[model samples]
Target chain A: MEFDMTKPVPETQPWSEKFWEGTKQGKLLIQVCKDCKSKIFYPRKFCPECWSGNLDWIEASGKAKIFTFSTAYDMVEPKFTDELPYTIAYVDLEEGIRMMTRIIECKPEDIRIDMEVEVVFQERGGYFLPYFRPVGKK
Target chain B: MSKGKIAIIGIGEVPTRNMPERTHWDIIYDTCMEAIKDSGLHKNDIEGAISVTPQAQPKIAAELSFGKLPEELGLKGCKDAVSVNAGGASTSNAIRLAEQWITSGIAKAVLVHHVTVHSTIPIPDLINFFARAGVDLQWEYPYGTTYNIIMGLMANRYMHESDCKPEEMASVVTALRSWAAKDTNSFFYGKEVPSVEKVLASALLNTPLHKRESNVLGDGGSAMVIVSAEDAKKMKRPAAYKLGDSVRYFSGTCVMRDFYKVAEGFVVTAKEAMAQAGITKEDVSLWNCYLAYPLAHPLIAELLEVAPQGMGGKYFLEGRMSFGGDIPWSSIGDAPGRGHTGSGVSTACYVETARQLMGKAGERQVKNCKYVYQNAGGGSGFNNIATIWGKEI
Candidate 1:
């Protein structure tokens, strides 16, 4: 499927450029605090745990477990109308960070809490967005 | 240091249903006028004014073109007049700010007002506005996460962790509808109360949240006149004094916090407010909880210590929160039945509580109401504000 340019695109900030660039190269990245050794998601410039500005990036293992999820059947933005019954979820990755992502390649009913999955990328709005799918599927 | 000296002497609200003809400022002006008239005080008695709306624009520019509330309302003695935007917690926070002003002698009497015109916006724009208001644009918004989806994710996790069945959650909807049926001002007033089965069977807005579980948006306005305790005794109407008040801000983004502890902020703020009031959980005669969604009703009840953790839904299931029940929570239909009117829902809670304390709530009044606990939060428990109102000092 082609990317939907009409959808909102991530505005990469000075701090988040590295993470977005990693996604473009088909890699999932998370931030690690150099001072406190804490793991972070959504790529913050400073460590929220210790307020430390010393941060580094690491490639994720691409493994995850569904923490929770919800499937939208209605009330979505008009641009997202074509992708009805879409599931948005929070997944606990092997890197010790919980990320908000979309779950694909499985029926909504089949999705369960703590279900193991792995990361996959799909281009959207000119960015390769990382999504999760049930392990051993597609 | 003591906020107990301030009291709410009067409260007013416009009919909280669809009113397409009324402008945003019209509702704000009329609500403030009604509240002032109800207080048995002239407009000149107002010394300060605070306005709360959901819009991101400044208060003066958003509410009226000519001037702020002090000038528009003709308060020549007004010492302070400003606007506040705290999402659903704005009104309660506004009251807290007004209390500080009165106790500090910055103003002898203060007027707090809130109005919303959510119904005037088109569906697509409304959806977009709500989406931006709740989601993190740089990360979550691009992924198509809307407000309902955020609440849906929270509900799913909460139900899984607590083993809360859908029927138990549906019981909250059933109870709220039952309460709304009694209030003539509610949007769902005189409507049939949906059964638990019907609620569960309703169209699923998102997984684990049925259509009826979400609030119905409407246009409405609410205002309150608060003054010092000394001034309150001189008024013709009975007063609801502020026993305690607290506001806490954690994280604006929902994903940054632990989803399991989503209601933790409510617990902290409520505990502080109750401690300040020198009361325990049992001293609360009525609970005017801000029920923006069905899931929140149970979650907030647990956090406020009215019901034990994991038992909030059970309280609703057993009918313990209905009018005349043991807990007497949400006696005036709250946001779900009254229709969520942006930040005005918070002020509406205070309005209903004041009426109950003054023995003015017609049919749904809590008998011998002495102390009322009001709680409101914004941005999925990002900022929690709690207030305790008492009939006696």
Candidate 2:
């Protein structure tokens, strides 16, 4: 029997297309405020702080600090059955905003809050995804 | 800063365990009405509102004002509102937002609501798989870790570092069961308490962490209404005032950090709360700390240096956490107990705190409780908040 899980599969909306593009470049990209001086992640057209319509995309420094993280042993989904006991994290970018991403190339016990990490790029489903490995490990 | 003079004029909860009959809006409406009734205020008195949850978009909940929740509850006049997403910290954030709104003169009174239907929300099995397959899934899901695993790891490390043990952790279950046994409204009401043996014998999801250390799931909604102390004084009933609140974020490299310490954010927020309230750790009589797992309590205690290294045991052994004592703790312990309810547990923590303050906590009420410490965790560990609630704010 397949493991039952919750949450509907997310569908890609048109506005999010660009987000997929930046991942392939091995660079993390997020929105920057045009009117006021601010940076945002997870790509948006306007500034969350100032609500400024003036916004543009900028590449990130590929640096992050592990804010908090978790590990999973249960393969609640079939696609994840083989990857049980993996790690996920909430990486706080040096730029201020936080993004949800996965950590790779490290043991679960090695992950900790405030761990420095750098981003790596990979392609999936014809789209780009941003993941991270320990800064010095790779 | 209403300058610490705001009371929780009303309190409402839709239900915790399960409610198949109610939609998210339906539960929100019910809890809102209950709060309105408790406050003795009409809808028009409410000039502001905050909805905390990602389950329902803020705009949808905002549109709910057209119905009885706001209209009949006398909130048709609300001028300021927001849908703040702080993960588990939503309730405390809601309280802070309400206080700011009232103090800023944006509105006289505000309603803060948090509702969750975890069963209704999707938890993808391949969440980590999808992310690691590289669509930028590095924070939590990449390693295929769920919230439980992360908490369990913390628990494992905490026990390894502290004097507490799995048996002592079982006290949380015993205490919660004892309280739930008394509260007929609780999800675990009438349930038998799990023996320490049972906790140890249970299958381990993460080493040193049993399945019984987490909170369970049930559909529910919670709401609180706040008014100025001046307005509260005019009411026929005595009021519940805003004592103080603080929100803190943690950032540092995991490498240089000590393994035994609680998350730096937890300590910072506790101090921030103390600073804001003009009180010391000694002044807080009721500590309603977050307990997503057993490790959180000890981690916070160790980090804050509030209690000596061994003080964590006294509270854990006595089941003070499960009973909702100062640093009163609750978590859907493991797979056996009430599992994670997502934002629902966040609301439940405040509900328990409010109940204790109002002297409505019945069997779980701590003696002479004057000050309460409530903390909420959120966003894969990036966000946290600690709130200080006092009887005479």
Candidate 3:
């Protein structure tokens, strides 16, 4: 059954717009503290480590490894019903930042902690949503 | 302020179930009135009030709707009134705030109130509420990371790191169900306790989380009245003194912290509260660790040093967390069996602990329950509050 892909879209704030725009352009951008060189995810206005406002964005390598994962077989939102058994995972990027994303192109049972994976963008609701899949898989 | 300066003199809780007909305000009113009556004090004696809710509604909304609990409940001399919105940690945080108010002379008597009516809303709306309340809306919610999924991720990581078998996780549920069966107010009351095999065979809501392992959400309300130590002595009933309290914070997201070290904030908050109480783990007579998810029981146990790290499941398997165990944990059932009602968990924990300390818990009471340690966390370990309640100053 085909499900409605018109799920809730994020209301981007001024600071996070660039990160979303980068995702649309097929590049994973992460914020970095200009002073302390500490990498940050989810695009915060100030550096969590150094409290530095002098921040810059760097394109991530689009590579990460699965830190942990869970597959939802039931009790999901109606909009997500068609995507039954979808795997949600937290992946550790090589830059030392962790991202919450979906894992596709593999059986749910095959997903394992610390397994290497890479980012892939899927267009939804006129926006590019980043998901991850096991490395070396089509 | 020094420890044991404030005491929970009275507590009350409304029956927990799916009460779609009742509004959140209605439940709050009922619980607060019941608590005041239990305290044997006039409403005019309440000088301060703290309200807690987990939905997107702000504290101001509660006051605007409920008309300042002090006024609605006919409190004539109320001087301070505030609403707390720390999610699951709101009740514990509210209790801590009440203690501070009594210690600072801001108020001689304070009432802490909590209510949740999520079941009154539509399922989809409730799901949306959970997503918006706990997840990072701009980045995580859009990606479909709901609260259950976040817990699922945590459970998966915890199992992987601890090498905790599926059967051991199921045992946590089995044991909690047995406890709930004994509590008349528990959602699982009158229900047959599920065996470990039954729990393991239950349908999986999310991979690694059986249907029995997740929280059974419901609607409920609870209230507690706290007064200065001097006033507590004059109360009609025995009082549960506030020995120590601490609130700690960590990353808002599960991915930000080391997955293997999931209980970092719990450990910090527990230690701080214990130290402030001038007590150690051995001194605690009862333990009320929040168990919204069965996987959290062992993790929190390990964090609190009730059991060795990675050996919490073993503690449960050996029947150590049961009523007859050396350390009586969740004798009235944790969230999974008692029912998860937003801020009601912590408030209910306080009420249960007070009852045990006062020798009021008939069947579920623990022996020698003098010092009761109750702890709660909010938003997937983003915030935590630990409180120690003693039978004496």
lDDT per prediction? 0.81, 0.63, 0.80
lDDT score, candidate 3, position B62: 54
Task: Please provide, for model 2 over A9-117, each residue's C-alpha lDDT reduced to its tens digit, 9 standing for 90 to 100.
Answer: 2244454556666676666777788888687654455676798888777777889987666665552345555666666666778887676667889988887778899
**What value of lDDT does candidate 3 attain over all alpha carbons?**
0.80
Write candidate 3's Cα lDDT for B293-333 as tens digits: 78778877888889898898888887788756677898767
Worst ten-residue run, lDDT, model 1 chain B? B57-66
> Where is model 2 more than 4 Å wrong at Cα?
A1-77, A83-138, B54-74, B121-136, B251-262, B304-307, B310-314, B318-340
Q: Where does candidate 1 stray beyond 4 Å?
A: A1-5, B1-3, B56-61, B64-66, B234-236
Residue-level lDDT tens digits of model 1 in B193-301: 8888999989998898888888888888888899987788777578898888877676777677675455666787788888889988888888888858777688778
* lDDT score for candidate 2 against the true structure: 0.63
- Backbone clashes, candidate 3: 0
lDDT of 2 by residue, B117-190 (tens): 55554334223322332122323233344455556555655665565777776665665565565554466666
RMSD of 2: 7.3
Please give the lDDT score at residue B228 for candidate 3.
Answer: 87
